[model samples]
Structures are given as C-alpha cells and as structure tokens.
Target chain A: MPRPNLAPPDAAPLREALRGIRFLLRRGGATVADTLTLDALPDPAAGLAKRMIREVEGLARSVDEAASAAAKGVLGGHDNPAEKLDEIVGHSSAAAEFGRAIYTALDAVLRRIGVDDAFISEMSARAVFAAWRQDHPHGQPQDWAADLTLRLLAARVIRGAVPAGSGSIGRVEPVAVFAVLLWLQSDRSESENEAVLEAAADIALARATEIAATIGSGDQGRIAALYRKYVDHV
Target chain B: MSKVRLTPDGLPPTNEPLRVAVRRLRWFKAAFLKHAEEMGAELGSRFEVDDTKLAAAFTRWLDAIELQRPADKSQRRAFFEFAAALMMRELTVDMPLKAVGEPSRAQTGSAAAFWPEGYCCTLFCLSVHAAATAQEFHADTTIDPAIDDLRHWWSFKENTIRDASFSAGFLQMLLGSQPNWVMPDVFRAKPRG
Candidate 1:
C-alpha cells in the first residue's frame, strides 16, 4: 500500500503562542516565572498576566503534541516523514532541520519562562546523550557527521544564534537527534580522530558562541566564517 | 546411524573444533545444492546462482563464524546447516527479489515455502554483512572478507543491498546483541552438555 503522507498539520497555534509569549516577555516587565506568580498580586497587571500565562502554556502544549505526532509518524514508516519535513522546512537531512524546528519552538517557550540559554543547552545536550546511551549502551562515536552536527546544534543553542538556513533556532525530530546522539556516544575511546572531533566540537561551539555574542547574531558572514573554521579544522 | 551423538539443540554431544565439525558435516555441499535448486525453482526467471561466488561467500561467512566462541556444543552442526540454507536462499530468493525489483504477487505467494526461522536467519545474515560493511566505510578499516564478497556478488546481480529499513532493523537487532558483540553475532553455537 502507498504510504500516507505523515507531515504534521499547520502549526498556527504554536506560532501564535510563541508570538504571545515573546510579546509578554518584552512588555510584561516580568520574567516568565514572575508572570506565573501573578495570582499573588492584587494589581490589574496580575489578571492580564494570568490570562496570558494560560494561553502561552496551552500553545506550548499544542506544539509539543504536534512534534510528538511528527516523531511517531517518522518512526512508524507511514511515509518518509523526514523528506516531507525537509520539504516543509527546506533543509538537508544532514542539517537535522526538523529537530531544529522543535528545539527552536521549545526554546522560545522556555526562554520566556525564565529558562536561561546555558541551562537549555546543557539540558539539551544531556538529554541527547541520555537518549543515545539508552539506544546504544555500548555504541561508540562512529559517524563523524552525526557527532559534528550535534555539537553544532548544541553550540548554536548555547549562543542563542539562529541556524544557518532557518530564521529561527529551528526544531528537529527527536529520532534524528537520537540517531546523532547514538553516534556521538558510540566508541568512547580517545582515538586520535575521535579526540580531534570531540575537541573540535567543543572548541567550535565555544568560539561560535563567543563570536555570536560579540558581533551580534546578524553577522552572518562572520558566523559562517567562525563555523567554517571549525569545520575545516575537523 | 551416524556415530555423532545428537543433543537437544540438534548438535553433536561432544564439542569439536569448527574445522573438524565442518569437515565431518559432508552433507553441507549436498544440502546447499538442494536448497539452491528449490529456491531457484521458486524464483523462476528471476533467479541465477553463481556457484563459485556462492562457495566463496560461504567460506568467508564460515571463517567469521568460526572465530566466535560457540554457545552450545551442538551448535556446530546446527550452524552449518543454517548457513547452507541461508546462503542458498540469498543466492536464489532474496537476491533475485532485490535484483528484479519488488517481487510479483505470484513470486510473493511462492514465499510460503520459506519457514519463519529460515527467513529470519537470512535477514540476520544480510543485516550483519550490511552493518559490517557500513562500519568499515565509516572507519576506513579493511572490509571483512565476507562483506566484501557479498558486495561483489550484489554488484554482479545489480542489486542495492543497502535498504534504509533493512539497515534500521539491523541496527535494532545489533543493539540487542550489545557489548557482547563487535559485529551482529546473532546466531550462537550451543554449548556441549
């Protein structure tokens, strides 16, 4: 039987929620956590904050549900969801753009919720590693591309820099992230190439984060050059 | 009756070196030929068996198997039989299906001849070879002789043996084998009682 197209439906709700959260973050004069605590306040702003918080949480849940459904479709072989996803997002499979989209959306929500970028990056890296360890208890760092891509994504998140092609940090399929994580966790031996790649990812992420911070996120040429420096070295 | 005492796992009661057991299993050639004929008959125009290449592939496969410690004493006989049946099916059935594109309904229907065990064994072997070859490619390590031979045979048949779903399934199976394996060593030899 011809497989059904399993592309996720329109994400208007998610987009709307992200916009609402971003607006609240900029204008509310309160951190995301502060907004959540508005019930304790007797001021008029408390009522508005309460309503906005509910809307933002509802939208975030909707995005999570959509991402989970897309992930299931990819795993179930309903279709080449990755290809459909790539078409929707317009990026290469290796770029892991689908995962970027999900991450980007979640990051937006988290940022508005008073979560710092460092914590987000650390958690994301740990989560990827945990998933990798679960799938491949003995797997070694075998695939260089997967390892490099993961480190790149992690670093981008740490710096709060947008992904190259996408205007946002971008979300990705968890399975794709998991696949890369498995490769990263595989072969923990400090072989020369493995050592070099590991170092390269670390050095690259740090340097990229620094460059993004100093020059601002809009310096695409410098950002590209910074990434290329590591890519070339590795 | 044969002097080789049979065990519960359908293997000889006493352990023998793989070479000795393989030498003793004189039926290997005959069994292989028999299965080859059956599979060829089933595949009809889509099948072609290259005896020289098939023998080479079998020897390479056997070499890899022999390196591993057997799980059961009776495993030698069972493994030899299993390998022969697997090679025969690959040479005739699966290879042809891959080569001629997806099988026709008539061809799919004919697969009733394959028992579930036989199908699993064939898939397991193919998955092992595929995984080994892919690892070799990534690591730039010398390819296994069996995988190299299989790749040559695949090329000869104009078949692309690397299917994504097949590789993913193989990875899942490989994960199941865990730290105990360097390759997808699914079939273990039975230990002697």
Candidate 2:
C-alpha cells in the first residue's frame, strides 16, 4: 500500500489562521489575568475565577472571528479559506480543554480559600474589559507581575495583617517585589546593572517574605521582629 | 559689511579686513580686557606681557575668523566670543602666542608667513572655551557638588567644541587630548577622602 501524502493542498491560509489564534490567546490571557488580579474583588479567589472565565471567553470570541473571516474568504473565491476553516474547527476541542483547565484551577483556588461554591457565575468579557479600561484610563496594559505583587500587598493591608501605623512597608516595597520578579524572570544574558538590581531585590524579598509570614500568623510582635532586621536597608 | 577676498594661493591676507579688525577690537575690549584684569589680580607679577607676540596672535586669529566668514549675526557673535576666549587663554594660561608677519604679496609666499606652528594655541584656546561654557551651563551652584558628579559632567562635555574651527591643524591637535580643567564650586561638599 502507498503512503498517503501528509501535506495539505493549501497550507498558507491555515498557517495564517493559527498565527492569529496564537497571538490572540497570549495577549488576551495576559490582559484578562492582569485586569482581574488588580481589580478590587471581594476575595482573591473570586478575582482568579473571574480572570479564568474572561480568558476563555476572549479566546472563544477570537476563534469565532477567525471562522467568520475564513468563511467570507472562501465565498469570495480568495486564496483557499476552507483550509483555514478546517484548521480552526479542528482546534475547537483544544479550546474546550483549555476552558476546562481554567475551571479546574479556579475550583482548586476557591476550595483553598474555604469557598465551596459548586457553580461559579461567569462574568461577561465586556464587564471585565470595561473595569480594566476604567482602571487604566490611558489604555496601557498593566504590568502583570508588578500588579500582582501590589495586589498581594493591598490584600495584606485589607486583612489587617500588618499594623495600620507600623510604617514597616512603604512605597519602595512594591518596587522591591517588582525587581525580584524581574531578576528571577531574566535570562543568562543579563547585564551587571541588572544583576545589581536583582541582588537588591533579593535582599528586599527576604525582608518582605518574613513580614508576610509574620502577618499570616497574626503575630504583631513577630512582624515587628522581621521588619527590624532590615530597618536601614530601604 | 566689506566683501573680504582670500588670496589666490589660499594664504590669509597680509592685512586684516576692516570689518574683522573692528569686530576683533570690540571683542578685545569687551571680554579680553575684563578677563585680563582678573588674571592680573590673580597672578600679579607672574603674568608676563609679550605685546608684539600677542598682537601677532590676535591678527592670525582674526585672519582665521575672516577666512571662515560666519554666516549670520549669531555665528559672528560666536566667533567674536571665541576670539576673546583665545586671547584670555593666551594671556592667563601661558599659551605660546603665534608670531604674525607681513602678508606675502608674492604668489609664492615667504616661508615664515606660510604655515605658522601655533595651531596648538588655537586648539588649546577652543578647549578652554568649551570647558568654560560647559561650566557656565551645567555647573549647579545650588546643590552641594560631589567630585564624582563634577567628573561625570566634565567627561560628558570633553569633546564638545562650541564654535567652529576652519583649520584642520587645530582639530588634529585636539583629537585625542583631554584638558586638565577645573570649575570652582564654592558650595561643594567636602569629599569622603
């Protein structure tokens, strides 16, 4: 028996469609996650759930747009759009799998936070995007890790974990967290200046983590003890 | 303004053009005289007066200015300031003045007036002016200056020349050289040592 040819007759349109889908998913996921994480949610678990739902919805919308464009291209007798349509249709199962994974993660996080709600009400993509737009009026994407670090700090404040007037963590605290995240994320080609920033971040992170642990235990004295280790660092 | 003509051989004219002379004299009175007085006060007996050599250097510089023929009022003023600065350096910094001779009227010029060796004087003069201008513009008297900060500022403006020089000879002299210059920051904090 002769081996069947694996190559599709028209591959260019399918490639274009896949490229568009990849860009849409990456940018959409990052934007949604950053937006939801930074917004003033009732709880951290709720924010993470909202972010997951919005990301899936965003991916689905992009897939629909791609399908529509491919159908129009086929009808107009343009470069073979049926090939692209088929590729997108074939990926529908994968998209569904991504949505299931997001739901599973949300469930796990909510359970850890002592929320056992079986059904999580999904938020509309428009609502989440609108909140993001309102927060960033200039339409610039929020730096995700920096926003996450700040939200974590704000969460600690909201929980009354740290004393209100202690003045232990000041404005520089967020910068320190951002630096550590950047340093960890950096590759081997990092410059000496960046290495210095990373080292400083390490020092700051050590102090911050200690403070966070103390706050978690609800021990004000321990929090003070950890903060005193680096009173002169900042 | 008179239309100053360059010699057919491209050697500077033996006589200074009337417009250049007037500009040079004004610069001498306005900036040179004031700076000379300050130098006299600073280095009382050590400041030596070489009247002939000084006049000769002034004329050579004026010829250089005339050859360059700055396009507008601003450029003309800049040249005048540069000339004044050059004279100030010549008087105070002990820069050897270039000797000027009578113009070679012959098509084949006399050897002495053809190519003068005081091109270094021009480079030193321009460098000093650059240092002075950088000092005037960037020197923050309000903040307590640090030695590191001052060194950074100086290094930043090391190669910058404020006025244009027509002579390749002068630019060649300045190509790789760094001048030892200082700005007086009276309010500077004492160094850590």
Candidate 3:
C-alpha cells in the first residue's frame, strides 16, 4: 500500500502507535478482561458492562444456545428462530450504549498521548512504506522486514506518555498500552539511571513483542525480528 | 421492506459506515445483549430485528479489529483471526443440542451447551458483512470511540429488559431457542482466494 508523506511532528505519535498489533499476540487479553475498573465508573453507570464482565461465562453460554436455536429454526424452516439470531447479533442499542462506556475508558488512554484512533491507518501505511523504502532505496521488493524490525527495536528505547503503572494497560485487549510503552520507552542507554523502569520496559516490551508475530500477521517477518532482538536476547 | 420498523427513525442502518464501538470481547458481548434487550423493551417483543442490520453491525465491529488498523491485507486478516480466537473463550466443548426441532431448552449450561449458538451469531454476522460488501467491508471505515453513553446509557438496558415482553424477548431466545439457515440458490461468496 502506498503511504502518505508524514514527518515526525505529525508522524511521531502515529509512529508511536505502531506496536498495537503486538498486544494481540500476548496474554494481555486476560488482563484486560479482568480489569474493568467498575468502582471507578460513575454511579448508575455501565450496568450491562458490569453484568457482561461479572458474568462473562454465563453470557457466552446464553449467546451460544441462542445461536443454536436460531440455526435450528432456519434449518427446520421455523419462522422466529432467525429473528432471535438477528436480535442477538445485531439490534441491541443498549449493548452499544454500555459498550461505549467501556470503549471510552480505553480510548482515553490512546487520546492522552495524542494518538488519534481514527488515523491509525495513516500511521501504518507510513510504516509499511518506510519499511519498503529502507531495503529498496532504489526502491522495490527487498528486505522490508529487516528494516521494519530494526525500526520496531529502536522504538522500544524511546520515552512515551503512558506510565507503565497506569494499570490501564490491562483495560485493552492484547495491551495496546503495552505497545505504546514498548514503542516509547526511556532511552535505556540514557535513562539507565532509572534502574527499575529500564528493567521493567525491557521485560515488558520483550513480552509484548514475544507473540506479536504469532498473534499478528503480514508483519510476522518483522515481528520475528522483534522477538529475536528482544525476547530471545533477554 | 418489512412492515414494522425494527429500529427507530434516528438509529443507524446496518450498512452505515463501518464503526466498532468497542474492541474487547467482553464489551462486545455486553453491548450485543444490551442492544437486543433494549429493542425487546422499546420496540415490543414482537418486533423483529433486521438480520442484515444485525449481521452488518457485528461484522463491522469484529472485522474492524483487523481491517481498519493494518496497512496490508494479510495482517488485517491475521488481526481479525486473532480477535476471533479471543472470542472462543472457555466455551463448553460439547454442544449436544437436541435435534433442530427439539433443541434442549436450558439456559444454564456450559460452552458445550452454548457454543453452537454463539458461533452461529458470529459466523452469520461475518458472512452478511462480507456478502454485502464483497469482503471489502473495512475500506473507508473507522473504529471511533463510543464514549458518549458510558455513564448513563447502560441504565436503559437494565431498565428496559424489566418489562415482561422485553425479558421474554431476545434474551429468552438466546437462553432457550434455536434458529436455522438454509442456503439460497444464488448467494454471493466473499471474495477470498
């Protein structure tokens, strides 16, 4: 894909967001699921979200049975089962409402550091093209992954806006916050004075990139590089 | 067009520009149930949710997890596949649903008891989304924040499902009923290699 021209001022935050996919590959999901921060929510807020999180297992079961009955109805030539499936899958305004609540909390984290959720694509296209450009200065099909992987490794050493202790890292799937922290770390060589953070980021970003290749696709080559340079080395 | 309007005048259409209000699986389930129950309360239990609309919505949300973020198509597919894996939580392995006509009518069961139904909802949403959009569903889409309603909207879902009709409507179907699908003669296959 062709990328839009973007410089560090506009591209810095966008560049920082490059690690979100790495979260999908890690065990970060369980952390997000378990960390709802329900008490932190305002009163009379997020009832469905509470119920959904509190009783995730039950809701999954109910949704399962419902899907079966609906399938049976259609196969049996029954009239209403399809409607049932339809409702569960699509038309729940209440679900959208409360889902928005949970979404807002996670979104705030991204916005806090100036990463606009809407423009992740622009950032990625730039990364992909940049990856392509590094190997092919003349520029064509080449070792794009190697260049991209090097970039990812470099990203880990830079400082970012997300505080590692935000625990908000647990709020999102696969830990986008983890990726943000990974891509934007304190320059280890420079911040070696902050002993704890350097060690913490090393382990965290390493783990963050550990399964990023497995969980993420297309960039597996580069992600493999991420794993080798970070996790395997650690 | 159908007789009764499944949604109100101002609501978004199933094919509205792609948007995923939340990416987390737990949130997805809650949001889905909340929407279904609210319709039961306000639209009347007899009201039928438009399947295309429903499928389109879920499809947008799920697929966007991959589609909107990845610059390359392969990563996009991989991202969504990972998202799907997350959905397959510790669901009961054995879905010993009775024969289609005589499905076992119990709500409280394990993934063995419920996954078939859950899979049906997810697969159907994916299909409908792909069919209508020719698998180009993610183009020009966005996963914008759905924060406006967090503080107060959930109350409606809680309160709405209280009515007998609402209580017995979609929620009941999920817990105890089964639906089926028959292939149409001329169906659009999603453009996959």
Candidate 4:
C-alpha cells in the first residue's frame, strides 16, 4: 500500500506561533491555550517563538493604524489639527477636492484590475464586506475595492453551485481565486498556487459551518462531531 | 444576515498595562516640555531645555510598547500604516483631480463611507501578509525588521479619521459559548494537573 504523504502542518513562523500563543493567553486559558503555551515547550527553537510574537505584535499595530487612516482619508474627514482649521475656515471644498483626487487614484487601480465593467453590483459588494466583517470581528474589516470586486464577481460566478457564468473579468479560473487571495494578502510577487488553494479551503470550511447550522441538521450528532473536530483542529 | 453592532461599552475594561502605559506617556510628555522650558528660559529659553525630560519621553514611548501585548505585531503594523496613511492624506489633500467632472453626491458619499474602514483593514491585511509570508520563506526575519523602509516606498497609511469603537461585549456575544480569535491554531504542551 502507498504511504500517505502525511507531513506535519508546517510549523507557522516562530513569530506567528508566538502570536498565536499571545492571542490565546489574552482570550482565555482554555485547553487549546494550555496546549499551545510557549513557556512550557523545551524545544530548541525558542528564538523562533519569540520572533513570531514580536512579528505579530508589530503587524497588529501597523494594520490597525493603516486601516484607520485609509478609512478616514477616503471618508473626506479632516486629516489633522491643521486640516481641521482649514475646514473650519470654509476650506471644506478643499477637503472635498482632496477626497476626489484620492478617489481618482483608487479608480485607476480599479480600472487596472478590469473591474470597471457591468458585472459588479452594490449588493454583491455588501455581501463580501459582510462576510469579511463577520470573520474579522475585532480587527478592521474594510477593503472596499476588494470587497466590491469580489462580491460583483462572486455573484456573477455563484449563480448556481456549479458556478455558471463567467466572473467580472471574464471566466473564473481557479487561478483567479489564487490571484484574488494574493491581492487580499497584498502580495504580488510569486503566485504560490498551493497557498491560495489552502485559503479557499479555509473559506469553504467556514461557509459550510454557517450553512449547516442555518439549514437545521437532521443529523445533530454528526453535526456536533464535525463542529468539535473543526474547533479542535482549525 | 444582519450586522452585529459592537459598542465600546460592551468591551471589558482596558487592560491594566495599557492604561498605565498611556498615563505614563502623557506624564512624560508634559514633564519633558516643562523641563525644557525651564532650562531654555534661563538661557535662550529653548537652549536650557532639559535633556532629562527628552530622555524620559523616549523611555516612556518604549515603555508603552513593552507594556503592550508581548506579541501583537499587527498592532505595530496598524500604527505604522495609520501614520503612513496620514502622511499620504497630507500629500494628496491639496492635489488636483483630473476626472471628467466632479463626482456625484451619491458617489462621493459612497466613497466617503468606504474609506476609513477599508483603508485601515486593507493596510493591516497587507502588512500581515507581507510579514507572515516573509517569515515563512526565511527562518530569521527580524521581529521589527526594516518594515518602515518598505512602508515609505509602498505608501503606508496612518489613520487620522475618528472611528467608533465596538463594545467589548461584542466578542462575548459572538462567542457565546466560545470565543473567536484572530490567531492560527497551535498546540501547547499540557500543564500537569
């Protein structure tokens, strides 16, 4: 018999592992938390864990600030004390004009992605945004461009379970999903096809759980078992 | 499904370290300025400023970081992104628009509605992706590596917009029986009972 290609789930980067530990500690000292604590391990890779922690902390701060600033910038709000003064003195038009400039830049980006077509819709955009918000409850969940594009495309593609029509930019190839996730990850360098597929699988798992819960499972025992396994592994 | 609203009131009290850090930072800033003015006032007023106060401010800022989560990289990225976005705002606030004409009110409103959350979220997502991906390829990426240089060229953003905070209870409600965390799953060695 052929042996299964069972490799250990690649250990997340040391910093990522440390981040996972810190987050668990912050949440609650559950079984999972106890299972993942960094201090208990006698592993030689201690530095890896420490770096992971630092990396996560650093990323958290950046994401929070960037998300907030980007949100505010495009929202037409005053930038700072100086800008506020400009607004108070009837420079509101100036602020509005500045917003327009940013909008134009954003529009250019959108056009480059070829989402300037009729395949997108506000409802689809809202759905994607809602899904993201649901997942990332604590951190910022706003990505207007991606959200808008995904929804528009998802609606066009997901007309049936088989994904009937072509997506916004035309045919929805598996690689397109990879590209989308890469863009979502803000990575443009190497197209790691495998990683993107993993991400899609993760999404599918989450969506499956939601649908099962809502549809009223006839096999409650099986549902409970599945949820336990998911919560245990994922 | 409908949106779940999270208000600040719903959140638990602020972490003690965070509160201490904020208070200490505020105190350090005030003391530094007073000391500077006192020393400077004697000479050119600015020349006699207290170096001690300046040192204290630096210490306080570091202390704030030390007191924050031991491993919250996203927090740091968010701060930088926030700063970068703010800089970008300053750069473009007085720029000219080349669109055919002014945007419609609805379009403008829609854009405004999307900017704040979208910018912050996107920046956070991007930075995390970059950092995490880089770490995966190399075993030894710096915890606080030369991300700033990348941000400078990549156009990082810092938020200047005011956003409403969700209540702490939001998570509690969502988790009901179990809390959801933005973390990867990892196994910890079990403690002896």
Please tell me how candidate 1 rates in CAPRI terms.
incorrect
Model 1 agreement with the true structure over B1-193: per-residue lDDT tens digits = 2111111122222243323333221222323344434443443423333333343334434444545536776565434433433343333333322223222322232222222222223433433333333333332112223322334333322321432123222222222222112222234422223
Candidate 1 lDDT at B136 equals 30
The candidate that achieves the highest lDDT relative to the unseen native structure: 1
lDDT of 2: 0.33
Deviation of model 4 at A29, angstroms: 57
Task: Give candidate 3 regions above 4 Å deviation.
Answer: A1-109, A112-132, A137-150, A164-219, A222-234, B1-11, B14-193
The TM-scores of all predictions, comma-separated, are: 0.21, 0.18, 0.24, 0.16
lDDT of 1 at B20: 38
Instruction: List model 3 lDDT by residue over A1-234, tens digit each.
Output: 999997535323322233333222122334556666777777668676676664755554455455434433432211111121112223433222222222222243344323333212223333543443444433211222233334533333222323344333322223332332222222222222232222323233324434344334546455434433332111
RMSD of 1: 21.9
Alpha-carbon local distance difference test for all models: 0.34, 0.33, 0.31, 0.29
DockQ list for all candidates: 0.01, 0.01, 0.01, 0.01
**Stretches of model 2 off by over 4 angstroms after superposition:** A1-234, B1-34, B72-193
Q: What DockQ does predicted model 4 obtain?
A: 0.01
Chain A only TM-scores, each candidate in turn: 0.27, 0.20, 0.21, 0.21
Q: Which 10 residues in a row give candidate 4 chain A its minimum summed lDDT?
A: A79-88
For model 3, the docking class works out as incorrect
